[model samples]
Target: MIAARILDPDSKLATTRWWSTTTLPDILGVNDADEDDLYDAMDWLLQRQSHIEKKLAARHLTEGGMALYDLSSSYFEGTTCPLAALGHNRDGKKGKLQVNYGLLTDDRGRPVSVSVFKGNTGDPKTLMPQVRKVKDDFGIKTVVLVGDRGMISQKQIDEIKGVDGLDWITALKTDAIRKLADDQGPLQLGLFDERNLFEFTHPDFPGERLVACRNPELRKLRAYKRKSLLEATSLELTKVRAMVGRGKLAGKDKIGVRVGKVIDKYKVAKHFVLNIKDHHFDFHIDTEKVAAEAALDGIYVLRTSLAEERISTEDIVRNYKNLSQVERAFRSMKTMDLKVRPIHHRLENRVRAHIFLCMLAYYVEWHMREAWRPVLFCDEDQARKKTRDPVAPATRSKTALEKVHSKTLADGSTVHSFQTLLKQLSTIVRNRCRVPTDGPNAPIFDVVTTPTVEQQRAYGLLETIEV
Candidate 1:
């Protein structure tokens, strides 16, 4: 199943037909497996999920280490599955049922375990169980949890504080940051004159530190996007006003509803002032509101329970930023490689097992990418990443940039993406050969194609990996 997902993702029915064309069935010792067999296998895997997760946790997680947790949802195809419901749709599949799941990974973003939840489950609702899973099930005592603001809200933080041996690093929501930047608040624009990152504290968050960051580039980008959205919203609202003027649109209720749709579509209602009457409709940008919002653009504050002695301020920000790695894992599972979305499984356990299978496949792919970094277009100087500015946007190293511009390694060999490299290796195949005259009575032998130098190089890198 992992091989099928990594190689080419499709429906299970297609997988049954697909595997026969490859050596996966032979390699996995499931040559005669049918669709029923695959479904039954998924059920079997789901039964052992807890045991499997414990083993992975033991391998990847350590006491006092950071565990990255994030929740994402995938749209489901059928409504029969109990886990599927209309919830926060991250995939932008309107009017589609989805199943929410949270991924837990170690500090380096190596996936340790995943838990599937009902589609309607709130993000914070999934946190405490994982905290228990790490401390109770995985037997890790003194661990730090890193999650996004939505996943670790103030309510969740209060709950986490009650638990011993558990620490957390998460950012404040936009509203919270806005409060911090208020006239008397600690987060002042002047604080960033010397450095982009500044650490301060508030009495509200006792025994915690807040690291405020300001990225000028991000600020500019946000300003541009806001201007664009405001313009777009204005353009749409103008059409509505024109309709009201031409008598095509009338009535106070109708004008308000039309204006509501326009503001909601762009989600910049706060920046607009609307006036509507029985026969008149007009809207204008509230410049003051826009400037207030623009003041907070590209400014975010990270909150962490860990102390400066245990972890530095920069490291705390970096750990919070590591949540992007989990995001990358989600991207790979959902669309890039695994194609875990639009699930058709009706059984809840089947859905859980399918997601687990995709996670396991990602585990393998992550290792392969790490091992093949020298040959692929991945940066080799990873140590630089650890030492670089945690708040600044990541930039590629000179060596990595060279590979990008030249499209080759030092040996002048072509650099390939992870997918293309795998495709290249797939060309090496095994065939059963026998002379025509001796085919009836002779013993057949497998003839494997000799790998090319490039294939050998790739294989050599992977030889050290222990599956």
Candidate 2:
């Protein structure tokens, strides 16, 4: 039953109890530690996964590729685990008990490893463990950890430099990186036939440099965004401020609301957020709006530790900034109806088991995305049009073992029994073990399944796998 549970999408085995009838079914041994029991199987699985980890270790993931890192938090109903806490929530579902999850993924979005942070813990601390896990578990020599501004700071930069080989590309907050670009007034390294991406190296920091990609499109986008925000704020403030002459708004607090609220027209206004030591944890717009109707078009600056030689500075800046793929994966994990929410069985052990299974579900979903994303629809309406319907869960697992059953080839009629089919298909291969001089390998085995007739019909769809 546990073996079946491991393969099932829902982790639920067949519902039946042969022991209730005092029938030990065809097994020769007496019951001691029931192999089919969930607890016993879970213990066996834990030990086996540990063995697999120790057996083989040498770049289980691809090299010379970027690793995306992102964090997410999920809610819990009751106090069953130690990690659950009340902290700042990104999903706006804050004040609810939650547990944080940090994920590391290869370039194509396969999960390399994961670490759980306490709900109350800061996101920045998860970086080191993510970096170390990739090096230790997968032997990935060259790594570029891609994260947003939330996951990095000056201390993180110092840590990256101290390490012999680790590169990071994070979005530079307005405060830390604004000076680099601000000092050079509207700096252009001379426009190219296309936009010229510049590679900036720091002399003080050895083996540490920055990639500044000049994205004309991005510049245009930012300019439009800033203009739109300025206009919107001005429009809002105008509506409120115009009421000031009518004596609607009064006192210093009201004046602060009108004066402070408006993005004054002199310069392009942008909110400056510094996420560093003694982090200034508020949104303060940087602009002096003494007059009305101001438009400022500007180029935003992003910094990365990637050397100029490996990737063109422009590509580095562009690629590193697009780490939303990892964030999307986390979003799917939390939003999916698999109910990954923590529901403990009054025991922390069960809680951990539940979380582990949820992680496994996420791993499977990630693999599915890697395979089928190209064929999937960009919109819900588009998806419903193709393939008639969603693929059933057992189609793949079942179709692989269709030969297990035999049909009734009788003189008058033909019939088949479903129980007989499973009986014929129910089998397992003994664990095959072969040790090599280079390294230990995991125990390998084979499994068989008998699909329902409906599953056999949908075999062609599930058979498709992307290269």
Best by lDDT: 1
Clashes of each: 0, 1
lDDT of 2 by residue, 216-269 (tens): 555567667766776676566566545654566655555654455454543344
Candidate 1 versus the native: TM-score?
0.98
TM-scores for every candidate against the unseen true structure: 0.98, 0.59
Tens-place lDDT per residue, model 1, 65-104, is 9999999999998889999999998998999999999999
- Model 2 pairs in collision: 264-289
CA lDDT for candidate 1? 0.92
* lDDT of all predictions: 0.92, 0.51
Q: How close is candidate 2 to the true structure, as a TM-score?
A: 0.59
